[model samples]
Target: MHLTVLSRSPAIYTTRRLVEAARERGHRPRVVDPLEVELGLGERPALYHRHRRFPRTDVVVPRIGLSVTQYGLAVVNQFELLGVPSINGAKGIAASRNKMRCLQTLARKGVQVPNTVMASDASKLRQLVKHVGGVPVLVKLLSSSDKGGVMICETLESLEAALEAILGLGQNILVQQYLRGQDLRALVVGGRVVAAMRRRARVGRFARSLAQGAKFERAGLAPAQERAALETARIVGLDVCAVDLLDADGAPLVFEVNSSPGIRDAEEVCGVDVAAEVIAWAEARFEAPPRARATAARRVPREA
Candidate 1:
């Protein structure tokens, strides 16, 4: 089988791991930057990369980054239009990219999530904070990734300052209840929790992202936690993703759903062959009959 990985660079840890995994499984793998993919439209939609028509691909695995979301989604959509199945579809990726949208979808699907509110009026900032449980609330850009546009405001003054800085730049933001407890990340693949980790923020910092110097250790998820993580991915319409949950009292409250989750940390901490699992899942779909494959492709939610 031939697998195509949509990524900015083949040097990226996750991309490299996937390439290695595919090759180990006796499959040909190619990494293409979504930005470099040229979409052609006519009687038949097509894609061209590096000035040549893209070759037939058995399956696509998108490692789209937050910075290139729009173009990346377009590239993924083009693949779908051409009947090329992808592990994660364009709608799922788009939904996960927008933090608020992801939370809303999960909550609507009866999954628990942190109390979050979005508004454009700065005059109602205090009310918005109160709605989410008050100061020390989280201020987040609607479409941030890797903890880029997230802020912890411990006071009204700070909340106001953060809001001004974000909204003044014309970016949408969400105010969420800041629940203090265990910070957990679960990597879900094909409706199963394949790896889990507990993350601790660096001393003197509130963010618990590995990129922010956070330390993580292998962790086991409670049945409920595992269920929530699985449900979050399904609700967001992704076959593979990472769900971030914060323990609120004894219950877990999902805070984020990452579509293109980085597997390096989870793989290292959990000692799981996450890349291989991802490849295997894609291979299964690739091996399905044409009718079954189309059915599976349509199972992934389409952008409305």
Candidate 2:
């Protein structure tokens, strides 16, 4: 089968492994920057290639990252319009990107979530904070989060300062009670947590995200943690996701979910083959819609 990876770069761990695995499975794997392609109003979205007609693709695996959400989802949506089967579609990406939507979805499913408030403007900030006990809180962007633009304010005064900075960035933020506990990231592939790890901030670090100088270790899970991760993905409408859970005062609170989750670090830390599991899922999903796939011999020539 011919599989196309709509990603911004080949250097990303998940993108490279999945593409290479597809090749090993006797399938044609092509990686392209979705930004390079323009969607045209036609039966097929014409890809602007250097030479020759672009090879027809079977499936699209979108490795969405901070830099690629704009052109990336547009490209993925075109494929869906053409009736292409993706493990996780553009709608799923959109749903997972919005932090509030995912949190609400999980909460509606009876998943424990940190108390949250969405303020359209700064006017409701003070009232919202009071309802949550006037304690320190965490404010995060609705989309594009990976420890990049999240703030933890330890006091109302600090919260106000943080809120001003966030709103100044021209993006709305979700204010939630900060769950004081260890952070764990559970990677769900094919509706299961294939890999999970406890991330800890090294001395003097704040956020437990690897980007924030956090270290990871294989975390032992209770049956409850396993159940929570799986359910979190289900309610969020994703075949693959990363569920961020925090234990707050002995109760686990679901904090975040990522449709396009990265597992290279978790896989290494947990001694698990999450990439292989992703390959298996793609193999199974692709099998059901064989007619939609390009055959092996339809490979893109290396020098054509």
Candidate 3:
């Protein structure tokens, strides 16, 4: 099978690993920059990179970055229009990128998530804070990523200041009840939990994201935690994702579904060939063809 990876940088660890894994599995793989691709129109819609048109490939795996999400998803949508299936797809990526939408979808599916509230009116900021369980809450901007969007407010005064600062920038915000528990990231690939890890925040930090100097180690998820993680992924419509869960008072709650999760650290800690697993799944999916959407009730977990 001819596999193409949509990435800005082919030399990145994740991209390199995926290319290597595809080769190891006897599949031809190449990296294409979405920004460099041209989208063509008319009866025969086509995508071209440089001066050459995209060739027929079994599947496309988009390792899109948050910075280029809009254009990246546009490219992915073009591939779908040409009947080429993407590993994560455009809809899934869009859904996962919006923090509020992702959490709302999970909540609607009866999946437990952190108590969160989004409000546009500054007058309602206090009410929103109260609704999310008062001060010491989290005020996160929907547009930021890699822990840059999140803020921890310890008092009412601090919360008001944070809200003003965020709203002043013309960004939407979500207030969430702070969870003091384990920050576990469950890597779901091909509808299965391939690897899970716990992120321990550095001193004086609340956000335990990997980018925030968080220490990580391979961790095991409980039955409930595993179920929540997998279900969250399904609801978000991602074939591959990392579900962030906070163990709130012993109950696993969805933090966010990350469509393009960084796999380097997880790969090293879990001793799992995550990239290889992704390629194996893509190979099978290319042959079998994917359903329009995954059934929310069905258990899609496979042996890892």
Sorted by TM-score, highest first, which candidate order results?
Answer: 1, 3, 2
Error of 1 at 284 (Å): 0.9
Highest-lDDT candidate: 1
**Ranking 2 against 3 by TM-score, winner:** 3
Give me candidate 2's TM-score against the actual structure.
0.82
User: How well is each residue in 147-194 modelled by candidate 2, as lDDT tens digits?
Assistant: 566666556566666655655555666777764436777888887777
Q: Which stretches of candidate 3 lie over 4 Å from their true place?
A: 121-127, 134-136, 145-147, 152-167, 205-210, 289-304
Q: Give a tens-digit lDDT track for model 3, residues 87-107.
A: 999999999998888888889
Pairs that collide, model 3: none
lDDT of each: 0.81, 0.70, 0.79
What order do you get sorting by lDDT, best first?
Answer: 1, 3, 2
Candidate 3 yields a Cα-based lDDT of 0.79
Residue 235 accuracy (lDDT) in model 2 = 76
Which residue pairs overlap in candidate 1's backbone? none
Q: Could you tell which candidate, 1 or 2, scores higher by lDDT?
A: 1
List clash counts for every candidate, in order: 0, 0, 0
